[model samples]
Target: MQYRRFGKTNLNFSVFSLGTMRCLSSPKNVRQTLIQAVELGINHIETASSYGKSEEYLGEIINSELPVSRSQIHITTKIPPTADADKMRWWIDESLKRLKLDYIDCLGIHGLNTWEHFDFIKQKNGCMQAVEEAMADGRVKHIGFSSHGSLEVIIATINTGLFEFVNLHYYYFFQRNYPAIKLASLKGMGIFIISPADKGGRLYTPPPALKSLCQPFSPLELNYRFLLSDPRISTLSVGPAIPKELEEPLNFADRTEKLTIEEITIFNSLENHRDSVLGTEKCSQCYDCLPCPENINIPEVLRLRNLAIAYDMAEYGKYRYRMFENAGHWFPGMKANRCTECGDCLPRCPEKLDIPKLLEDSHNRLKGKEGRRLWG
Candidate 1:
């Protein structure tokens, strides 16, 4: 497997890192997968506290079999922002206890979605204090954040010069975070990609339109190749469902051949196709311009639209939208119907999407409403 410099850090991490999200079901299975990955030379393992018993299971494996020395491998875990300072501190201590480790190689501020959330971390003294304390005490060697927002938020965070790494979404299908990744590289921050293949589900099948865009190569290989093409990307955290899933990437990594020019052309062709399909006025389902003024999940709602139209899965879209609505993650005031045509989000978009008009159309289509409604 090929290894790359992890930003400015002296460590060389494998291009593919094992993500433990799906490893919660069986401890033995998880252990075997980790052992196989390490055997194959994938030394970086990432998990999160939010992934439900994943940490516990991973802790069991490391304690039982894996060597405890820090030099042999790098471990990264996240602390969710929802936990207060004391609670976060307690959780980190518990995480160490559970992982049976002396210290985490890297720790990140988990699931930052908006500027407000970023402000909360930087200003409240709760999350930031805990992170600082963790570093000072040598419980965590480096600090970072995982963002699901725009380049603006990422730049803002980097400007603070507080983090040593960042985990964000970057893939063949979506390159929303490309600019931020480049910026992070320039600023000397470790870049870790999360779940690039399973973004819109499985790799075996993709949207017919998307598949057509990947003409010369299979969708799965095309996706990995796309990410691997960029030198700034340090590692890809793939959530392996089984040992084979882990092994498949190892095979891809072992091959010395690079993507051909034809493959590059085919991949580049996606730009036009994506724009044509999603339209200039609508969100591209990239989730970059998020934390809307009224709490609407612009990209997620648009994803439902795309799934409904592109795949003829209207019922699925409706079901998912209903779930979002019921979860109270979507603000009633920021419903597509509530768009006032104020035109605030257009300039903020990297895609230059026509936000107001798209929201107008989405509200009508999703809610079965006739006309526009104003946000008060």
Candidate 2:
């Protein structure tokens, strides 16, 4: 496996780190998956306090079933932001107990996906203070945060200069977080790309159109190649559902150092096809159509519409579009059904696109039962 120097923390992290969110389906299956991942040179094992028995499974397997010493593997766990310093410290201690580890290599403030979460962390004697105390006492080594917030919020958090690294969403299909990724890289922070496959437009089971667009490379490999092409990315989290899921990424790791000419050609072709299919209806993501009276994310809604129409990504579009009211701050936005044909956003749009009509059409095309986020 290819390894990168994780920015400020200076840990040598595998390009494809194992995320243990879905690893607790069965103990034997999870044990084998974890062991296989370690055997394949994935030293970074990421879990969370909320991932339901994930830390316990890792604790049961690591140093027992896995062929590695305690010092060889890097264990990362996250705790949600809490205003109370004592509660934050308690969460940290609980994570350590579940993992049976003396020190966590990386401890992240999980789901910093809103200004409220950021405020919670930055409040006097809050979560950050507890994490600092943990660091000083040798219970935690490096500090970071994972976010699913808007670009503005993410950049705001990075500018705090408190975190050594960040875990956020950035994938081939979703490039909205690029600016935040670049800013974090400039800050000398480790950039861990969370859910490159699953949340990355559900590439594991790509739509037929997207699958065809990928050509010689499977959707997963093409997406991996696309992400690994950027040197700023320190690692990509691979949350395997089973042991077999690790094979493809392990094989892809052999060539992650660089993309070939053909792969580059495929990437360009994918972009061209998306643009051509989207035509004039493409949302440029200029944020000009902001401050919707109904609080709908106009650009994001239109972007999902474009994907559903252009790339036969209706299922993926529905999966996300339906998360409007359900995902809370993690995916903060109202559905396009609430557009109300207001003329306010009309004059702001530079593309001269029919905002109300398209939003209504998107609502008709993508609306469904609300979906739950994979995690908060």
Candidate 3:
């Protein structure tokens, strides 16, 4: 596997890191996948306190099955923003306890989705202070933050010169954070990518246009190759459902073939026609244009829309849509159908998605449908 220096942390991280979001719920599966990942030379594993039993599962594997030492692998975990100073400290200790580790290599503030969210971390008695305390106490080696916020918020956070690493949504299809990646590198901060594949739900089945563009190469390889082409990316955290999915990217890690100029040009051309290429229906889950003045969760609505159509899970989509619509904290002003096309959200979109149009389409189809189920 190809390894890259992880910013100022002084650790060489594998290009493909194991993400424990889905695997943690199944302890046996988690053990098997993690052991296989280590055998495949994937030494970096990322998890969160909020991702069910991920930490506990990792602890079990380390304590029971894996021969790997704490020094042999890098463990990255996160704490939620709602966790106050006391709560954050408690959670970090809990994470360490669950992982059966003395220290976490990197600890991030999980799910910083808005400007207000960033401000909350900056508060004296809030998450940042809690993280700093962890660092000082040797509980955490490096401090970081994971964001699904706008480029503006990311830039603001980077400029503060506080964090040792930053995790954000970045991939080939969604290059909105490209500049931020460079900026973070310039400042010597670790850059980690989250869910590049599952975010769009098309890594396994590339949109026909993208597949045709890639030709002989599988869509999954093309996706990982495109992300790895950028040297600034420290690691790509993949949420693999099984061992094979976890090992797929490792196959191409050390290969020498690179995308040619013409190939890159053709790929770039797809950007202009992305909606048609990837289908406007499949939400990339790039929640950049948020804090919707009307409080519409443009990304979540698009995700439900895609799930409804891609899997024919209209009832399931409607159920989730209703949850969001009814939850005052999530989506306030606008139901899916209530978007007025004010176009205020357009400029904020790094992906340049047409929000009003998407919301209208989703509400019309998903609300009245039945028998929707989760895709297998």
The number of the candidate with the highest TM-score is 2
| Candidates sorted on TM-score, descending | 2, 3, 1
Choose the strongest candidate by lDDT.
2
lDDT of 1 by residue, 146-260 (tens): 8765567777887788887888877764565778888899899889988876652346546565456566666777778777877778888877877777766666775434667
Task: Give the better candidate number (1 or 2) by lDDT.
Answer: 2
Q: Across residues 139-215, which tens digit of lDDT does each residue of candidate 3 receive?
A: 89998888876678888888888888899887664566877898999999888988777653356645554466556
Q: Which ranges of candidate 3 are over 4 A from the true structure?
A: 207-209, 255-258, 272-293, 297-336, 341-376
* Candidate 2 displacement at residue 84 in angstroms: 1.1
**What TM-score does structure 3 among the candidates reach?**
0.79
**Cα error of candidate 3 at position 345, Å:** 7.5
TM-score of 1: 0.79
Ranking by lDDT: 2, 3, 1
Q: For residues 1-376, write the lDDT of model 2, one tens digit per residue.
A: 8899899999999999999888688888789998899899999999999898998888888867789898889999999988999999899999998888899999998989888888987798898999999999999999999998888888999999999999999887789898998899999999999998888888888898888888887988888888887889999999989989998777878666678899989988977888888888888788888989999989889988888887788888888887887777878888888877869999999998999999999999899775555435
Between candidates 1 and 3, the TM-score winner: 3
Report the number of backbone clashes for model 1.
Answer: 0
